[model samples]
Target: MESNENEFNPQQPNEHRPEQSAYGQPDQHVTNPSFKSKLELTIFSIEHLREIAKWSKFLAIIGFVGIGLNVLGLGFFFLLAPNMSPFAAEGLNIFAGFAGFIGFVFIMALYFLPILWLYRFGDNLKKAIDMNNSAELESAFGFLKKHYKYVGILIICFLVLYGLIIVFSMLGGLFAAMGTL
Candidate 1:
């Protein structure tokens, strides 16, 4: 018997794959493509999801607090930068304060979206489970996906940056060694 590559086969080892359930269960739709509804979650899965929602909400709240702290720190720095010994000089104070503020803002901006998505995911998931609304469940998963994708992109960017830093550091060392010889 010949098998079609496009068809999902549960028996096959990675030969074919199908979309998983939004709640992270093995979708039965893999075998029966015509199934329109998402697989229902078991009691065990619901408990697990509840725990996850609680944790996600906690972490997101912490992240928001951290951003708030960053804002306060930035304000405090500007207020005190002129008084700090090293940056007391007008020119040095302005430049250092501005640079620090810019860096802090950039970091905060980079982290804000992922945290927001996480918060929304947790909120939506909790509501969905309580009400048994499929639309809310789908929206919750969408937020989760966005949270992961945004973080994944950031990780990739940082990895490439680190690789470039390493390459450049090596090249600089090589040139320095040859210059001394």
Candidate 2:
């Protein structure tokens, strides 16, 4: 009986397999596909992600405070509007009062808008860290860098608007004084 020796050995290492082409010989027919050539891009680094997570609570707290302040401002305006001569004598018409309230609410939202992005950034960073996607982790850091400016803008706008409101209130007081005179 003749014994055949060509059968592949299961115990042999993959490197020694017959199917492997010549050493250092690139596959000419296999042009590199652009998609396959590169690894997936992620947003954040592990260190940055950990930092974000560490500070997430602080950001959340700041957001909560901002939201609370806005709510207080809204309540103050609503409570005072009815006592003012403009709305009081006019009976605070439903449509106009509602419109004004909406506008105030919109402005308040703008003031607290950074809180929204901060919350989102923290959440996304946490998720990326959990998923172990370094690229995504870096992306989250990039997002924070890009949007922090917007947050700053929101803060500045809120301060400016608040200043305007105070100026108008002072003017109103002056008019009341003139009326008394």
Candidate 3:
């Protein structure tokens, strides 16, 4: 049988097809149906990201140092609790111990988590930039999100606590004035 050059041979396939995507092996045409190109805005420069990472690393170091100092201070306070001061009020030492415990659980632990997140953000940002890995870059931003979310929550809690304290103090002052009258 003579081979017809006009007709495509069963053995030969079209080689001009667009490259397939990594996710689904779908051709470029299937993925992007609209011929219009999508444009994305760059809000920050890579230099800015690098600068932020550097600052975050520095802050993380400082936070870890502060946490270490707080732990040491708490331990020292407990160790010296029994040494009675002539000026100390009744049960002051016990109250201090309780306060220290609360500080360890609330302040120290809370501070530590964000510090770790900041540390991770800095580390991931550096690695992502160096290796040009998109996943790592996303991970770095996620750490930042976690850090901010935690801090915001803590701020809100503290604001509410302060508000309550102010309200109680005002009521106490009013009661004290009434008692004096």
Best by lDDT: 1
lDDT of 1 by residue, 9-96 (tens): 4343342545446555556653654545546689999999988999999999999999989878885776555566357665677677
Per-candidate clashes, comma-separated: 0, 11, 0
Candidate 2 ranges beyond 4 A from true positions: 1-51, 61-86, 93-96, 155-181
C-alpha lDDT values of all predictions = 0.81, 0.61, 0.72
lDDT computed for candidate 1: 0.81
lDDT of 3: 0.72
The TM-score leader among the candidates is: 1
For all predicted structures, in order, the TM-scores are: 0.74, 0.45, 0.70
